[model samples]
Target: MGNSTFVFVVFILVYLGMIFGRLPRLALDRTGIVVLGAIALLASGHASLEGGRSGIDVSTILLLFGFMVISAQFRLGGFYSEVSRRIAGLPVSPGALLGAVILVSGVLSALLTNDVVCLAMTPVLGRGCIRRGLNPLPFFLALACAANIGSALTLIGNPQNMLIGQYLNLSFGGYLVFAALPTAVSLLFLQGIVLLLFRGKFLLPMAAKEEPERPFNAWQTAKGGIILCTVVLLFLFTSLPRDLVALGAAGVLLLSRTMASRRTLDTVDWQLLALFLGLFVVNGAFEAAGGLEIMKDGLSRLGMSLASPSRLYGVTTVLSNLVSNVPAVMLLLPLVRDIPGAGYILAVSSTFAGNLLIVGSIANIIVAGEAERMGIPFDWKGHARVGVPVTLASLATGLACMVLI
Candidate 1:
């Protein structure tokens, strides 16, 4: 076979691996697939280290790494625990707790990535709901759905939004104008769904509390707070590259005297980083092979351009569910050109689409992982019950917002 054909075959395998969540439990993960693809490209003389590196967006990697550090700081700090405790402490009905979960999930997701928000909040909320005589599943699903919906409201809400905003050069505030309304409506819709579907379950008798007081690390919390604030300010006010600003904050958090640097660094999900790198190399190769151009032409022939709001929305939603949002965005990005309000469409659709399935977004997976660790049975069917309808409702609302705004 020709070198290009071999490269293409390896690339196909890599994506297939992504689709199946791994290479069928073969000890290889997404990152391994990506790295293997890069090696294959080089071995077959289809590309070089220079080409591969050039293809990977250093800015995107830097930004993601930095945010991971920032998120790690929060995880150690007990901020998430504290917040969950405060929310649980509210003198409200079971319904109100559901609303608070959705609200907090959305807001926190807008600041931190949705996945991190879920990672931090899931256990706390889950335990709280169980103690409150509430079925934890509804609340957990709310957290996942709300986070996905809320992340759509801002450029930094999720990784895909960040990539689209950075690549398309969408202003921070501009994207918000396009997404805020849809997100607001979607949150309300989510609240209603939980209240209707799980009302009886939520009102079940309370269980005896195991630990009345939530445990947290003060020093870790302080470090995380400082770094997060610094990164947000830099992203909002300063001219520094977003990636550099985030990485700098991460570096500072890692140098703390309280926590072991290795421990803190270990919390960073290197597999996710690997997934990004592998997919970047694989997608880059496809682009280099003129595959992307062909896609763009085919899209054009169908009277679709990424610049068209509805078309972009449909594409992002479909692709997000297919390959997961982040990787899907990476694949489709080249077809999109800089256009007014396009970033918002991409962000809204890709993020909201995550609510489509348990595996549709990393945030959902993070919540599921944490829930499993806590002995909660959060299976795909359980998730799909809430996920499917909520996703459809939210996507329709988002599409309407795009049209109106």
Candidate 2:
């Protein structure tokens, strides 16, 4: 078979594995599948090992790794837990509490990684709701939806955004101009939907109970907070590369005397990193073999042009749901690299699309699983009841925002 044909086959298998989240009847996960695909290309003489390694974007990976480390510091320092505990303990009523949840989740997810935000907050939020004798479903649902929406606010908010921003060389400040308004609108939409759907339940009397929480480590929290602020500021105003700024912050956090480097580093999602590396190689091999050009030609014949922001938005929304946002963005990036404002559109649409279904985004999945573990029983039907409406509302608002701005 030709090199292009071999690369194409490998691409198909890797994406299929992504869609299924694993290979059936094999212990191999999505990361393993993609790694195997890259290996397959190398063994078949379709791609050189050195060439495949070069396909990986080191800056994107470093940025992602740095953020994960920063998030880990926050997690271990009890920042996330303390914040949620304070929010839940507020003297406000249930409706206000829900609004608070939405606002906090959205903002934090925008700055921090959304999945880590969801993972850290879900358990505490669930426990708080149960302890207060309030239904946990709406709050948990809001956490997931808001995190997904808020994550669209910045390139560092989620993995796909990071990849798109780094690969397309998008300006962090410029993209935020287009993203902030839509993300705010989406968060408001999500809050309203949850309120309308779960009305009357927020007025329940608070039952006093012991809320299990990590003791707030003031020093560690302060250390992490300072570093995080420095990183964000550097990214915004300085011409310094984001990866270097983030890695520098992570290094500062790692130098803590009280916190063990091992504890902080352990929180890094190495599997996700591996998955990224493997997919980078796989996609690189395909691109090197001219597979992207072939796909572009096929799309052209079908009268589909990804260079158009609107069409790219629609395609990203569909593919994000079909194969999850990170993989979807990776698949689409090579095609729309030069399209004006393509990065911003892809980031917003794909991230918002995660609210369409529980399975659509890793953030949603993390929230759902965490809720279930907390005995909240967050099933698909409950999720879709809120997800579908929120997603549509957000997407409509985001699309309009893109057009207007």
Candidate 3:
């Protein structure tokens, strides 16, 4: 095979692993495939680590790492546990409890980023549901879906959005203008659809299981909140560069006398960061190998050039489900740089479409993974009972809002 063919083959194989969540008859997972792809490209001279160094966006990585530290503070301080306990403790019916889960998850994701929020909140919420004699599947589904929908509302709410906003140089406040309404409407749709699909199964009893949780610390929680707020405000009002601002906030938080820096640092999702780096290098190789030109022609022939916002939305929704949102978004960003409103197309479609499958987003995977660990039967089938309707309703709501107002 030619150099171009080799790089393209590697890219397809890596993404196939991602689509299936693992390689067939092999132990290689999505992260492993990505890392190997990047290594293969560098080793074969299809891409250069030195020349393609610029392919990796350090600012985006810093921003994601910073927010993760902030989220970790909440997790370690037991803030997430407290919130789940209080919400699940309300003297309300099962429907009311589901609403509470959706509401709290949506708002928290909008602020804290979705993946970490789901990771921190899932077990507590799962245990809370079991304690209340309610089945936890729907609740887990709601948390994952609401987190995805909620995280759609802002530049920092999810990894793909952060990558989109920072790389596109889109205004923090400007992106919110397009996102806020759809987010509100989509959260409502998410609640209704999940409730509808899981109609008779809401109050089924499940055995109680305790997962590891941190003791509550008010000082650490408060400190993390202040840092988060300051970082967000700077993102909104200042042009100090979001990466620098986020890194600064993270730096100051690391200087804590009470919490060990090791513990805080341990909370960061280093694997996700590494995955992003690997994809960047692999994508750079693909583009340099003239794979982009071949793909463009193929897409043009297939009548999905990605210039039209509607077509872009459809492709993004499908591709997001197939490869997960971050990789799908990373692959498409360079293709849409000059397309008007393509940023919104990517942000809304990828975020909302992630709710379509358990493998569609990291938040979904984390929640489902936690469910298995807790001995709960909340797998992809149970998830799809909620995911499919919720995805359709929310995507329609978001796309309409994007087109209309």
In the range 197-249, model 1's lDDT, one tens digit per residue, is: 87677754545346544368887787677777777767667777787777888
Over the stretch 1-405, how does candidate 2's per-residue lDDT look in tens digits? Answer: 877778898899999988887887899977899889978877877666573354899899999999999999889989899888888788888889999999999999999999999998887877777767788788989999999999999999999999998998889899888898999988988889999998876544444445567778888888888888888888889889998888888888888778889998899999889889888888888888888889899999998998876677778878988888888988898888877777788889999999888878988899889877665578889899999999889989987987787
Of the two candidates 2 and 3, the one with more favorable TM-score, higher being better, is 3
- Residue lDDT tens for model 3, 45-159: 7777674443788789889888888888888889998898888788998898999999999999988889988987888888888898988888888999999999998999999
Q: What local lDDT does model 2 show for residue 110?
A: 91
lDDT of 2 at 261: 93
Name the better of 1 and 3 by TM-score.
3
What value of lDDT does candidate 1 attain over all alpha carbons?
0.79
What TM-score, to 2 decimals, does candidate 3 have?
0.96
Which is the winner by lDDT between candidate 1 and candidate 2? 2
Per-model C-alpha lDDT, please? 0.79, 0.86, 0.87
